[model samples]
Target: MCGVLPIRKFILLFTIAFMFHVSLAQEGEVASLSQNNLQTYIVYVHKPEGLHSMQSESLHRWYQSLLPVTTASTEHQQQRLLYSYRHVVTGFAARLTGEEVKAMEKKEEVLSMGLHPEKGFWKKSNFDKGVIIGVMDTGVLPDHPSFRDEGMSPPPDRWKGRCDFKQTANRTFVCNKKIIGARSFQVYDNLLHSFSAQPVDEIGHGTHTASTAAGNFVRGANLYNNANGTASGVAPHAHFAIYQVCSLDECSSTDVLAGFDAAVEDGVDVISISMTSLNVGQLFEDSIALAAFSAMQRGIFVVCSAGNSGPSSNSAYNAAPWILTVGASTIDRNIIATARLGNGDEFDGESIFPPNSTKRLNSKLFPLVQPGINGQMLSQNCNNGSLKDINVKGKAVFCERGMEVSRLDQGKVVKAAGGAAMLLVNQEQKGFTTYTDPHVLPASHLSSAAGLNIR
Candidate 1:
């Protein structure tokens, strides 16, 4: 069977070693080995209910008897058991070979075998009043008005988390009824970074994500005089337990696992992680995946961001069937900014910045320039190296999307080049998805066809 498959990919998969976990549940899932080729896996045994201590011990004894330790690839190193899941699933997690999987399937206690995803998700909640939500992200801005818990009672008695105040902006980590807990982690002991010692959210990413998930409502909410109005989280009444596991956009797997370890021990209901990588490693070593399995055992829902690498094949991250992945979208609401070309042609673009500081979106028109008109290679992408030669002073610089060119960073680079405004063109893959970012100067994102017509 293996010889009949696509030779290269199949061999690569076996060489790298994929992961799979067997469950005795009635439900079944089919997995494709086409995408993942990582070593190390987590094996799960179904936990049958109504079992006393002795009966549970018997199940464990029977499963452990099947795990025959083999010599690992590393010289003189034997196969090792990484983690034990006794509370949620009665099993041991380890790295096993294909032969081991066949042996496992033959065992009388094993029901079925399939590749389990490291990712997980849930949907359609009954909106339980003020349910606890644990947010594991960059870090939370505890003092931000979005976290204010007004007219709320005390923390749930089951909450066992504590707050950390070191190096915070307010010199203390504030937690009220809505925000039940605040904690930070930095497992990179040997790395060199200023905030390596404490949990402080200097970058506002954590604040934005946490608030968007579970922050309470705040009146007169506006950032830079835009999106001005009342702001509220998707779950306004939901209580939050904030875990800061990332610093400066570098999320450590060890730190993420530590957060999950605490979230489970402290009894969190739901976990919201807005971070995921394009490539996932082995499940046994995958910090988030391993954590999600344990959380699922305890009936916890895990939600994650699907990443912006979409519109391309395999550009998606967090593809593990267990984790719920979310893609961003635009509503029917459109704020029109008319970009009238010099040749009497006009194209509508999407933008959030005003013509001036106190103005609305697309308040006025400015002279637009294509950076490549001066014969600059890679200039249209607006990367750092190409900005010096182009004279974008007092003019809107046109930029194309892709090639490690962050959608938001294009505006920043154009502004730094003394450009008065920006007209960003999207690639065809993006289609009609027009996204607007806060620009240092007035900037708008247009569709690929709109950009071609403008040029």
Candidate 2:
């Protein structure tokens, strides 16, 4: 009976062992077999802490050796290791939310006021809804009160975006906090790099030019006080989108072109360019002009200041046919007065005045004088020269027209000599006004006779 029991137990153990071996063999065959003969799997490897640099290679070689000889040859080699922890895992299908869309749209309004207010023609149509005007200049002061409204509702969705001033690997597009639809396209060192603490107006020219186009009309009296300090722009209600195109030292044509392209792609409605270059052919072939033309074809208006070299035969980039050239005209078309002081009195000489039909001051007109003399006082003939010990404070200084120096340059001299204002008379010819406001402190031009009288 005992022998029979032992035999029964042996048969049972054999049967179980044989079934288990068969199952293992079937599993191994299935593992070796691949569907479509092209199956692949993605593997993410985590390295051991404090492992040597070569440990990964050594570990891979050891792992490869452990595979069955046949399976090893058939297995495809595909391995990826992540060395940096900065990147976040994300799928390509991710999209911006509704709130983000509104944020992006608001950037347009903010940019419009900063760059091109005249282009915001919608204001004329009573459309409170603003358009985007991109200013590819320096960064803007986002905290300026002109862009903020105390009681207005929040901006709509679609105007939100990111700002990447660092120009890191892929960071770009900064959204304005106060101005809805306002965004800045600063490309690190490439273009629009912010160096100082605030996007300040280092060169007063940019601030002046920008203020003339779309300065914020904060107070009700701003419109009436256009003749006063920091007057209102042509379009006060419009918004601004500032793009820092030029830096403190230099400006690059390539950066300007890139900024233009980005502005168009972002759907900016207008682009105001205050800068000018002498290279016409280069500007024409430039991708910036082409992009601007594309925007123009889409009904976008482009306005630019005529080079200060106007009132002469010399033409500048703004003079180009495709651009709207703006020439500087004295307010009310009045004759710009240039006065000179000597011996504590005012006089004018040889400076040619504007046309007789031109506007004049309502105050009493002093009698005209000759090239070297005034009515009562004998004038010192300093042909575009300076006077010594002259009480020029709160008074005008008269300088001759010729000296081969710019009127502004002469104005600086007068200003440095403690002169309050300057009057530059034409020396070479008549019927022309030199753009002198940009040069010296509060300056005006006078005819040769008016200049002599003031001198």
Candidate 3:
């Protein structure tokens, strides 16, 4: 991953969030409605700057009339307008049916409209000075040496945000020269209450992504004696602010919008979010997309992840074309591991073991076995109860991927079963693509072809 992302290449005219697919709010507008039946869409109302609020309301009313707002909504709540963009693009994002979108499109005030999101790509570039990237993710671990502000200049004078400025575990986290601001949101759907927490990250995901974006340089960085090198963010000299939008599974729309709102208000030049919703479309009704559009109007670059559901067709989220959606690509790096079977067949794979772990294993081989349920090959599941009755003592048991459980849990189950090591096999659909994950025991994972060949 590149260390820091540059905030250049912003378009000035179009209020942009790349369009993805068509929406069907009800049976009449299209054959079938999508999973989200909210009749919601981002309405791109075309108008010049400086229009009166009354004119904007007229446009909003015309759009909202297509589908009557649910009564559960208050007079204020019924105005389910997430963003009213007036600068870069003169439009409002709202819940509109397919017929509404079509009818709204016919209006002279509307520009363009369509489905959800698209794709993101990254290229190698040298870091430039004076960029303040806003990172909206899990949260940052302020104490990691990588975040030190030594030898760095003061934060850019334009920054106007505050530290979440709370104390936790008797430690107070305030912004320094590197991390210019910190905040957290607990909103659920823009109607939730507020709470505070420390900025120190309990989960490493936020720190990892933040560091990759603009972390300070740290020497001797490695993954357990692997990929040894100096560590730094994509734009090492760039200042950054943190908006902790998630402590739960992914980020709720309310929280994500709160993060974007704060970032734009704080004069952030760019926003990078590594969150997405599964089975959700690219409707302006989506909190993140709507907030991103507003940020775009203010000339802030927005970058997001394309998600890890790849190696399968149509498995990507955040495919919005206007937003920069990025995907992970492999480098030349690979962990050195081998799967040697009892039949003298040896195949190569990857592992999370340190560079010197082979010396500890001593090139030893143990009885390799694949445990399954009911002789149906499902025994290799390796989940908690999937192996309780199996005799895995002192043997190297092979586990199968998928079943919606954590990969590390499989290794833990093997270790708890008195097994010496764990051999994980990928599902049939997953190919040579592999990720190095932690394990409770000495373990490695094989590709579908490799594991099947071994079997």
TM-score of each candidate structure, all chains considered together? 0.60, 0.47, 0.64
- After superposing candidate 1 on the true structure, give the runs of residues whose Cα lies further than 4 Å from its correct spot: 1-128, 166-170, 187-198, 277-285, 312-316, 319-322, 342-344, 355-371, 374-420, 427-433
lDDT of 1: 0.65
Q: Write the per-residue lDDT of candidate 2 for residues 34-56, one digit (tens) a residue.
A: 44332222122333455335444
lDDT per model vs. reference? 0.65, 0.43, 0.67
Instruction: Give lDDT tens digits, candidate 3, residues 1-455.
Output: 43432211111111111211222233223323433444445556544455355566665554444333342244633655555665566565665555545665676666676544321121123343567888877788887877888656777788888887566687767677888788877433233555455455676777888887777889998877877898776677677788887764456665666788889999989898777754444454356666777788889988877666655998655666657876665766787567777677777777776656556664677887789845745457887776778899998988888666788888888888899888888888888866687567778788999888977
lDDT score, candidate 1, position 45? 62
Error (Å) of candidate 2 at residue 167 is 18
Clashing pairs in 1: 119-323, 120-322, 120-323, 120-324, 121-324
The RMSD (Cα, Å) of candidate 1 is 20.7
**Pairwise lDDT winner, candidates 1 and 3:** 3
* Per-residue lDDT of candidate 1, residues 25-140 (tens digit): 22112223222322344565654454435465565454555564443333312233445556776566545556667666676655554445433212133223457778877667
Query: Quick one: best TM-score, which candidate?
Result: 3
lDDT of 1 at 416: 84
